[model samples]
Target: MSIERDHRRAAIVALLLTALLSLPLSGSVLAAGQATPATTAPSPTPDPAAEALDRAIAYLIEQQADDGGFVGFEGVSDPGTTTDAILALKAAGIRGVATESLISSAIGYLEDAAGEYASSGPGQAAKVTLAAVAAGKDPTQFAGIDLIALATAPVATPAAGTPAALVGPGVYGDDLYDHALVLLALAAAGEPAPAEAIDALRATQAE
Candidate 1:
């Protein structure tokens, strides 16, 4: 299957797990005016959602490479794909023995790729920031670059009737995806997003 298909499946699995986890446990609540004796509640049946999530986790674990990264497009091991897998597993509450080693390896790969990611582009920087935050690393110190700053850097626009270009603070691309991802990364890093960036993104949306 394609990487995009895999991503969609992973998202579905995470959402299923989230929904399953939100369900109330099988138990009885006592009323304000209690009866003579409380009745025993039936044992909870096995949850199909939990079972599916376990299978998904196992599949993800099997896909993990020796170097700790997951396969992306064209079967290439990529940090972004690894990050997505890690976040998906996390969302499903699949940790401990089932995912500990996988998570550790992926984190190591991301840390090692920090420099390359920082030099790539704003999108890459945003993705790295998200991954770093997910792995409990500080984005400001990752690969010796402030990923948040790199992602939020403003692009230079040519000024009319002037030789000098004007540079302003905003998302690097000022496009929807770049702005949205950067904002997400900033939120994940516990940093406050700039109001101007939010406004800029909002203005670009189709009415």
Candidate 2:
């Protein structure tokens, strides 16, 4: 009798399992279950890179001041860092209405500060120029000033009729980093860097 009872119980369990398995479980049913139900499916595994990017973007957004510029350790709204952030977002291909508004406000700040930027060194000017160009703004006409021209003004041009590298300090900034950065920005702006600037940068590499 006990053996018969056990066989009956097992058959009932198998029947219930078969009924559940045979139910019309379509993809839509699974998707709907996954979408609203915190239960039917296993939770999706979070991507580490995506999570990190979200955190980084959030941090950057949080650092923005009312002027739409980011602040440095000095707690002062710095155009340099702000430009860095803008270029970063542009490079990452981030998009949205909020992002566009954020970038626009930052550009507005740069525009208001363009006079001071015009008077700054080539390195600083080039940074602003790149940031402006990346956002589809005209560096030549930004704030009624030609940022591209301003950026390249300090670079020495190759002596007329000569393809020789410039002697002495090739760039106006404190080091070659400025030279490289300015050259890159100039290229991005669709402006050719001075011949001397190119030669000077090339000259840095030992032959």
Candidate 3:
């Protein structure tokens, strides 16, 4: 029984790693040679990365509970996991009225739990912020110490003695991944991002 359990754990870990890795590859820009404009401005081809994200999102939708939230592998509709899935679809350019409605419902679920969420935890708030940003919605609905921190902070590279990330910054167990989400959200919103954030992202660009 223990061996079977161990194997199950390993498999779950593998799936998570694959999902996290696959998440970032879903927003590649078209190559210069392939950047021709549409004929009469016709609709563009479906991006391969977007197609991949659609499959992932389809799987997630299939697994959603009757309550309209996904049941995490661990249990419950964890805000963190849902946030990641939301951001992935958004990054893949899945922004439509239907998508927005679905995201709004999920936000309701997270809101119900926000009281217990750490007041000033950057990590937790980041997930919600990213999802809201992706949906092109204002984040005024979510206000807390963490949210305040974001509004007030210099948005600069962390000063000396500062950590690369704070505990609870959305993509748990992976500092770099969380940082990537923050950078992605800022870019999508046309927000003025810090040079260090840009530099850090450049460092992670895949060849």
- TM-scores, all candidates, are 0.67, 0.68, 0.49
**Steric clash pairs (candidate 2):** none
Model 3 lowest lDDT segment of ten: 165-174
- What ranges in model 3 sit over 4 Å off? 1-58, 88-100, 114-120, 140-174, 200-207
Indicate whether candidate 1 or candidate 3 has the larger lDDT. Answer: 1
> How do the residues 169-198 of candidate 1 rate in per-residue lDDT, one tens digit apiece?
654543456567888888998889877777
Model 2 per-residue lDDT tens digits across residues 1-207:
999999999999999778767778765445322563455778999888777777777888888899888887899778888889888767545533246776788888888876796567777888998889878999888889888777766445433433233344445454566667788888888877667767787877777
Which parts of model 2 have CA positions greater than 4 angstroms off? 1-43, 94-98, 155-174
Please report, in order, the local distance difference test score of every candidate based on alpha carbons. 0.72, 0.74, 0.56
Q: What's the lDDT for candidate 3?
A: 0.56
What's the best-to-worst order under lDDT? 2, 1, 3
Task: Enumerate clash totals for all models, in the order shown.
Answer: 0, 0, 4
Ranking by TM-score: 2, 1, 3
Q: Which predicted model would earn the best TM-score?
A: 2
Worst lDDT run of 10 residues, candidate 1, spans: 158-167
